[model samples]
Target: MKFTGSIMITCVKATELIEKRQIQSLTLGERFKLRLHNSMCVACRAYQRQSKTIEKAISRWMHITNNTTHHLSQEKKDKIIEELKKL
Candidate 1:
């Protein structure tokens, strides 16, 4: 879907497009619209930058959490079991 230079999108639509682009590929029209909007709108550009930062942080957190391992020591496990039995 090619858009002529005449079409204009609102900031809300542009931000939604930014988010959608994160999850999936966007059509050329959508990409063009977003870039055009971002170039003209300061708030939308800031929002897009913030969104990208948040996505990067979340991805880093997920990677760290997935790779790390946690374990309870035998003493702690035994104590917890004994306490449960008393209850």
Candidate 2:
């Protein structure tokens, strides 16, 4: 963080920060470094975009999968509904 003000984070570090950012909030210095790096590094900017797209896709897939995971047989559902009606 001491060197973050003027020094641009390396591509590797920038990419790491970008990934880290997807799951967690960054420190002020880390945010600064990432912004500095992305401002001047076109490749890192592209990488950030790609990383976000991938993360969103994975997140959406997980959400969809989770919702569908607790599958029930049609017979089981019908029994449950009939029991609920009795209640």
Note the Cα lDDT for every prediction shown: 0.87, 0.86
Pick out the ten consecutive residues of candidate 1 with the lowest summed lDDT: 63-72
Candidate 1, superposed: residue stretches over 4 Å from native = 1-6, 60-87
lDDT, candidate 2, 1-87, per-residue tens: 366345656899999999898789998888988898899999999998898899889988877756546678899999999999998
* TM-score, every prediction: 0.60, 0.58
Q: What lDDT is obtained when candidate 2 is compared to the true structure?
A: 0.86
lDDT of 1 by residue, 1-87 (tens): 657655599887899999999899998888888888888999998998899899899988877745446677899999999999999
Worst 10 residues of 2 by lDDT: 1-10
Q: Which parts of model 2 have CA positions greater than 4 angstroms off?
A: 1-6, 59-87
TM-score of 1: 0.60
